[model samples]
Target: MTNPIPTEKTPPDEAPRFAELAGQVVVVTGGTRGIGLGIVRLLARSGARLMITGRKAHRLERVADELAKLGAEFETRVSDVADRDASRRLVDETLAAFGTIDALVANAQSYINVKPLLEITPEDFDLVLDTGPRGTLWLMQAVVPAMQARGRGRIVTFGSSMGQTGAPGYGPYSAAKEAVRSLTRTAAREWGRFGITVNCICPASASHRLPTNLDGDDPRARAFAAMYKDHPLGRDGDPLADIAPVVAFLLSDASQYLTGQTLMVDGGGILRA
Candidate 1:
C-alpha cells in the first residue's frame, strides 16, 4: 500500500475566516485605525469590496495601501461622519464604487472625555452626541433607501459598556452611546419590514486607546487601565479576535434573524440580563 501524502495547512493569519462574504460590499466609518481598522482588515481578507472613510487623508491612504496588500478592492474617502452632507456623500460614493451597499459599520466616534457629571458642559455633550447618534442617524438615512430597494441590509453601530452600565466618569460618551442604542432599536423596528437589520456592539476593546494622550498620571487613564485588570479574561478585548467577528456576523446572512440588540463584547466586564 502506498503511503498517503500529508496535506499542508494554511497558516491561521493567511486563511480567510469568512469566504462567504466574498463579493459583499461594506462601508466602514473611521476605518483608518483601532477597531475600525480591525474590521476593515477582517472584511477585506474575507473578500469584501470596501469603501472606508476616515477624517485623515494620510491615514486613509495608509489603510488603503494595507488593504491593497490583502488583494482587497477598496475605495478610500476622507470625510467626517458628523457632517450630514459628508455622510450622505460617503454612502453615494460607496454605492457608486460598489454598485450597492450590503452592510455598514458606523464605527467613527468623537474622542472620549472623562468628566464628573456636574462638570460635563453642554458643549461636551454636543461633541459626543453630534459625532455619535447624530452622525449615525444621517448615515443610516443615506444608506437605508438603497437597502430598502434591495430588500436587505445589515447595520452595526458602535456603543459602549459604559453606556449600559452608566459608568460615572464617562457621562458624555455614555449618553451619546445610549442615544445610539435608542436609535438602533427604533431603526431596527422601522426597517425590519424592509429586511434591514440594525444592531449595536458595546465593545471593551484595547484599540480604543488614543495615540495623542498616553498620559501616565491621569485619573481617567488609570481607570481605563483598571478595566482590563478587572475583566474576567484578565485583559481588554482585541479588536481582531474579540470584536471583528461579531461585526462580521452581524453583517453576514447568518444573523438575519437578529436585530435591535446591543451586544456587550467586554470579556464579561459588563453583562446585561
Candidate 2:
C-alpha cells in the first residue's frame, strides 16, 4: 500500500465553534503562544470572553493585535502562574473583568530541560514541577471557588502522553505532567459534586513551533517534523484544528457530565483509553 499524506485541517482560521461557548468567560494561562494561543483563537471565535495571561508583555500585545484583526476583543495581563500570588491575581482580575469565570484553561508549562535521566539535575525538576503541576494546582484552587459559588464550572488542564510513555530525554517534563494527571483526576472527583468538571488533555501537535520559528539548521527540526510521520492519522495535529475543539467541548454545557478523564487529542499517534 502507498503511504498517505498528512492532514492539515481547517488552517486554524476556520476553526469551528460550539454554540454553548458563546458569552462564556474563560481564563487561559500561557495564552500568548502555541496551543494556548490556538485555544484563544477558537474560544474568541466562539464568542467566549477571554482573560489571557503570559510571561511576556510583548507577545501578549501581539496576541491582542491579532485578535483585533479578527474582531475579537480580549483582556491580557503579564502573569507567571507558577507564583501562588500571581495565580490568584489572574482569577481575581478575570472576575473583575467578566463578573464570573465560566471556565479555566491551565495550559502553561515551562520545560526547563530535556535530557537523559542520568544527566538531569535537581533544578530541572524544580523548574518543570513549579510551572507544571504546582502552577496548575494554584490556578485550580484560585478558580474553583468562583465556580463553586455558581454551582458549575469547567476546568481543562494540560498533560502529556510522554508522562506514561517515558519519551527519551524528557525526564522533568514527564514527571511534571504525570503529577498534573493526578491532580486532574483528584480535582474531578472532588469537584464533580459541585457541578464542576475537570479534565486533562494530552496533545501532540506542531502548534508550539510555528512556521516563523522554524530554522532548518536546528538540531531538533527534523525530529519535530517526523513526530507523527507514520501516525494513524498520518500527521501531527494542528493545535487549533485538532486540540482546541476538544477543549471547547469540555468548556461548554455539552460536556457537563464528563469528568476525571484524560482525552488524548493527538490524532491517534498513541492510543489509550
Candidate 3:
C-alpha cells in the first residue's frame, strides 16, 4: 500500500521568479532538517542570506556546511526556542552578522505521541504548547520590533493538518498549533501598518519525523494514501518543490497585500474551511 508519489512540475510562470533577494537576510528556525531544510535550500537558490537555528550544534554545523557549498551565505546557531533568552540571542546574532533582518520563519516544533486527554500529563502539555505557541510568540516579539523600525518584514509560522481538523489522539499537538494560528492572525492585525505580513503555512507531508509504530504494510499509511488518492493534482507534497516558492513569494514584495491567512500545502487533502 505505498502512497503514490506526487509530481511537482513548476508552472512556467510560477517558477522562482521573484525579485532577487540578494542581500536580504532570513532566519529559519529548525532549519537543520525536513521541511525547514527544504525552505533553506529554496531560499538559498533564490540568493537569500540565511541564518538557521537548531538545538543540536553538530547537526546545525553540518547543515551550514552543506548550504555553504551551494554558495549560500549562511550561518547557524544552536539555540532552543523555548528558552526566551536563547531565542533573543539568536536574533541578535543574526542582526549583528547581517546588519538587518528581512524575514523570520518560525518553524521549530516538537510533537509527541498521541494520547487521550486523561492520559496527558502537565509536562506533556507544556512541552507542546511552549514550543509551538509560546516559542512562536517569543520569536516574533524579538524580531518584529526590528522589522517595524525598518518598516517591513515577513513572518511565516508553521501550523499543521492535525491543528486544523482536531484529529483524535492529537489533543496536545492540536491545541498548540491552534494557538499558532491565533497568533498568526493577531500578529498580522497588529503589524499590518508597518508593512509586515504575518501568515501560517499548514503543511502535510512525509517529513523527517515519521509516525511511530507504522509498519510498512500498516493500514494507517494506507488510509493516508487513500485520503490523498484523489488530490486535485495527485500525489504528496515535496516540501522544497511544492512549498518553497510560495514562501518565497510571501517573503517577497509581490505578496505585500496578503496577510493573516492560513495557506495549506497539503496536495488538496483538506479543501474546505
Q: Which candidate should be chosen as best, given lDDT against the real structure?
A: 2
lDDT of 3 by residue, 220-239 (tens): 45435444545566655665
Candidate 3: TM-score?
Answer: 0.90
Per-residue C-alpha lDDT of model 2 across residues 78-149, encoded as one tens digit per residue: 999789998898888888888998999999988764467888888888999999999999999999999999
Tell me the whole-model lDDT of each prediction, alpha carbons only.
0.83, 0.83, 0.81
TM-score of each: 0.89, 0.91, 0.90
User: Per the 3 Å backbone cut-off, how many clashing residue pairs does candidate 3 have?
Assistant: 1
Q: What is the per-residue lDDT of model 1 for residues 95-153, given as tens digits with 9 covering 90 to 100? A: 88889999999999986567788897888888898999999999999999999999999
Looking at model 1, residue 62 earns an lDDT score of 95
Candidate 2 — which pairs collide? none
In order, how many clashes per candidate?
Answer: 0, 0, 1
- The alpha-carbon root-mean-square deviation between model 2 and the true structure, to one decimal in Å, is 3.2
Error of 1 at 201 (Å): 0.5
lDDT of 2 at 20: 80
Clashes of 1: 0
- lDDT of prediction 1: 0.83
